[model samples]
Target: MQIYLPIAEMSVNLFLLVGLGGIVGVLSGMFGVGGGFLMTPLLFFIGIPPAIAVASEANQILGASTSGAIAHFKRRTVDVKMGLLLVLGGVVGSAFGVELFGILKNLGQLELIIKICYVFFLGIIGLLMFVESIRALRDIKKNKKRLKKRHHSWMQGLPLKMRFRASNLYISSIPALVIGFFVGILAAIMGVGGGFIMVPAMIYILGMPTKVVVGTSLFQIIFVTGTTTFLHASKNFSVDIVLATLLLIGGVVGAQIGTRLGLRLQSEQLRILLAILVLSMCFKIALELFVAPQEIYLLLRRI
Candidate 1:
């Protein structure tokens, strides 16, 4: 299949890209993730250049997150202060990450390094989320009441407390900033949108309600990804705006459907399923790193 794209004149199959985008969009809508994690990998799997994949993912994330954030905002589900703090930290972290990427690229082990980190982090996150959700589910079943509000302690006692009216949260801003910084760096390094890590961090470490976590994370992602897009375009000129727009069309529609599906699932069920999917992918990727592939070499000699 040959398609003429506005950004690049290359013969490519249009259906594949759009289909991949649709799948990613569904996941994004369901989880409130930027979906770059899936999109970037899928692009690579389909033979796109790594640099192009990374740049395009950033651009696509900007659009998808912008749309998703708008939806979240309409629901009054975004924590603006927290999102901004995270974005600030994320930007700084992304700078460091970009430097690290350059260093690793020179070392010629960037791919291995990235894969190892992805697998390790993804596995840990998935397992923890899965276990937590299972417990939450059991509680919901045993007691027909919602989980009790956890009392804030040491975290809230820290200095430099800031109030977030939207989330009704009064906590130390430093913690969020620190968390965002690390998340941003990872996102930049791995070419992911960082929602996977950010969502968990916000809910567990930051003690934000899960209901608002997705929207707030999307808000931060827009800034983080937008910054990433600018950085790539300015330095590499790898940003494929047309490819991004194509993906965005599919992503936007998929997100709406996924969002509706998410509404039907119990919170615990959704978390557990998401956790399992994440962990399984992590394990699969990790196995590729640690396990050797079967050899199928053939040698022929004629005398």
Candidate 2:
């Protein structure tokens, strides 16, 4: 059966829509990402308008992240101190991003700009994660006894340093704030929970453990995406509740399954898989732009 998205002004297969959500929900649970970076692009390729895809995705992520975060919280992998700092920055960034999205929409550059941002960020982050994960795997395979060591980073010199017991590190609040802010902006513009960006940043830059970062990233995504959803609904009226609801029905269940499966895998394995997924999404979306147009979608507005 097909369902009409009032806001998107298109009909999509109900099963396909829910199935996409389920797939993304699994990734969200396993990787501690909201799966927006992946889902939004998929929606675009499937004939949804870029603006509608972005706004509706934010709504769906709110539901999916909430479900996934609960599982992480139960495991005690969340760093509250770090999460709070990220949230503080996210609020301000989300507000600014909503405005920017509206401005771009008016200028008729929303689709192009959104695709460019996705290609650029996904390529960089995915490549970095893939390389790092491969090295980590090699060390494990070689029976290398990796000592727990904290090396000095320039970010450590920043002011307002604080200790996070959960991740077993002391880092400056500045880095988290900056990362959170950037993630928030991406969340609003890209309809992502910023997990794709935040997860890697937490691991490499903030030096947070992978386990802790996943839960913390989810927590931060919930708040930032909530703000993004409200702003898009109020300002752009682009959110399709019907579409979000269908997606959430499958997403809520898939998340729990993902969390359980994730616990069985090594951190390096998780990172490598996520890296490949991100890269795959980037390439797929990039191809959409160069390919000749083969489908037509009509968008209607309420009079």
Winning model by lDDT = 2
Error of 2 at 258 (Å): 3.4
Model 1 clash count equals 0
Identify the runs in model 1 with alpha carbons over 4 angstroms from their true place.
Answer: 3-12, 144-153, 156-158, 209-211, 264-276, 293-303
lDDT by residue (170-262, candidate 2, tens digit) is 778888899999988998898988886787788778878777888999889999888889999999998999988888887877777777878
C-alpha-based local distance difference test score of model 2? 0.84
Clashing pairs in 1: none
Q: Could you tell me every candidate's TM-score relative to the true structure?
A: 0.81, 0.84
lDDT of 2 at 54: 90
* lDDT (Cα) of model 1: 0.76
* Residue lDDT tens for model 1, 157-233: 78988888877788888889998899778766677888888887887678888888989998888888888777767
The prediction achieving the highest TM-score against the true structure is 2
In order, candidate lDDTs are 0.76, 0.84
Count of clashes in candidate 2: 0
